[model samples]
Target: MVDHRQRRDELIDVVWRLIVEDGLAGITIRRVAERSGWSSGAVRHYLPTREAILDAAAQRVAELIEERIKAVDASAPPLDALVAVLAAVLPTDEQIQRASLVWLAFVGQAASDAGLADAQGILYRDLNQLLVELLTMLAAMGFQVDGGPASAAVELQAMLDGLTVHVLLGRVDADAAQEVLRAAVNRLLTRPPEADG
Candidate 1:
């Protein structure tokens, strides 16, 4: 007998692949089952609705991203840690690039779909919290943030998001993106008031 967990994971994998290939519009019970070599009934047994499957896929992607960020070495300096976190978010290779494509598809689908929108909100909040934590650490390390921790966190998060979009759209290469981020961090960390004196 096939393990239910394994079967569910297979379904999610199939859904992710479909999303990468054809966006959210490409995912349906029959299509996913066909891609995974599972029966439609089996797919339905695991995910009774399209929304459920999408929510599962989104959650899985979030978990994978969190896992990647967590794998970075926390013992490094705050600047190094921040760079590592940003690097994890960027699609530097083929596997991560595919994941990024799936994420873009999910975001577009979530914009008009109320159910998926809620999941997207949760993921955004979680990611923002992670960024806030990183920003707070930077502040502790004497970074001269223009505003309070919360504001700095939001700004840095926005910058990272913009960079991700540019990189994914081919407007910026990975090396150029890294340099931009590094320059921004350097500017953020430099003590302007001290330099003025």
Candidate 2:
């Protein structure tokens, strides 16, 4: 019996591989069929268009990051867990590197593609909400967030987004990005509350 879910995942994997090798422009129904060794009709049966392929690739990256975030040690020290959550979203490893690049490509194309733009907005909202929850938890655990959890999540999200680009562009390596993220989180967690005027 064909495991439909497994087949879909394999197709998405092929999409990411193609994106890494040739950018988003490299993706096509026929190309995916070739790469996955499936018939073009079969590929179309799963994802009817190039946009669908891009959407799936972007979604897979988000899913991978969320899975990593959920797997972080809840029992670990608060700071470590926080770092692990943020780090889970970074493109620090081979798998994440490929996935992140595909996501970035999709985001870059979103500027001209309304469907992709909508998906991008939803992705940002979901990720932002996740960060807000994490920040709220840290605050409850005795960490101080400089601008409340919502604002802190925005700041952390920006830092994470920038660090991903920097890491991918060779401006900073994975270790450096991790250090930067750690420092940023530490400041957010440990900064003394502002004095009233």
Candidate 3:
């Protein structure tokens, strides 16, 4: 028997790509169906409403991040592993670039959508917690956390976001972004933070 879940997933994938490329402004059941070579009725079978399509796209983004993190080897050094996690989210390659673009749209849409906003919050919280945990581990390893683990996580996350934007704008490359990410962590582990802009 054919799996209905798989078909739904396929439809979600099509919508997800649309969001990534078009930034969530023009997505509709008819558009998604046309993109996927199906009828609007068929797309509705998977996502009955525009809201459902948006939710599925947001969910796929989270799933993609989770899958990337899960693929990292745990035996690597803590700092190296952390860099891998951060780099995975950077717009360094075609796949990651697409994900990052889709992520921007997700953030914009989340402003008014309670459900999408909540999901974005949860993802942010989880990543922030992981960074905190990593910073704590570094401190345990005798690194000087100039401020504190909690504050360092917040700062590092903000830096990462800004760096990712620069990367998308062609002002920074993947290697440069990775270097900046590592240096930010190093500075947090060593020096005091600069005054907020």
Candidate 4:
């Protein structure tokens, strides 16, 4: 018997490549089957509808990033750790670029798709919570932040989103994007905690 889970994952991967090559509009069940080296019938057994395939592809991209975030080293300095985590979402390399393509494509879909928009809202909420946690870490490390941590978190999110868009459009390369974000983070914070305090 064919492993449905394995086949489903393969189809999702094909959709990912198709998104890179053709974007969301190019992902049909037949197209996925053609690219994934499976028959349309087999692909359908895994994904009964085009929407199902898209949802699977989006879920797969989310899972990949979540796994990367979970795998970050716990012993790094607070800012270093936060940068590492945030970089997972940025298109800073080939692998991240592919994930970003899928994510940004999903984001584009969100404008017209209520379900995707809701997912984006949930993602933004989680990102906000992460920023708050990281800002608290900065406080503990003695960084003076403007407008407090909550406001800083919102500002940082906006900055990152804009940078990611610029990077995606080739207006900025990955290194430039990273450096810009790092510089922005530094500008928004100051005065690290004293050793004696």
Best by TM-score: 2
TM-score of 2: 0.88
* Over 4 Å off, model 3: 112-115, 190-197
Q: Model 1 compared with the native: what TM-score?
A: 0.86
Extract clashing residue pairs from model 1.
none
Estimate, for each residue in 63-149, the C-alpha lDDT of model 4 and write its tens digit.
777777787886776666766777667776777778778878878878998877765565577678888988887877788877888
Q: What's the distance in Å from true for residue 113, model 1?
A: 2.3
Model 1 lDDT per residue over 1-197, tens place: 86988878878888888998888887788898898888889889999988888888888878877988998998876677777787787778776776677777767888798877886776677878987777776666666666766776677767877887789999999888887777776666654343321
Candidate 1 minimal-lDDT segment of 10 residues: 188-197
Write model 2 residue lDDT over 67-175, tens digit each, in one string.
8888888877677777888888888788888877877877787899888787677668888998898888777766678899999899989999899999999899888
C-alpha TM-scores of all predictions: 0.86, 0.88, 0.83, 0.80
Off by over 4 Å in 1: 190-197
Ranking by lDDT, best first? 2, 3, 1, 4
Better candidate by lDDT, 2 or 4: 2
Rank by TM-score (best first): 2, 1, 3, 4
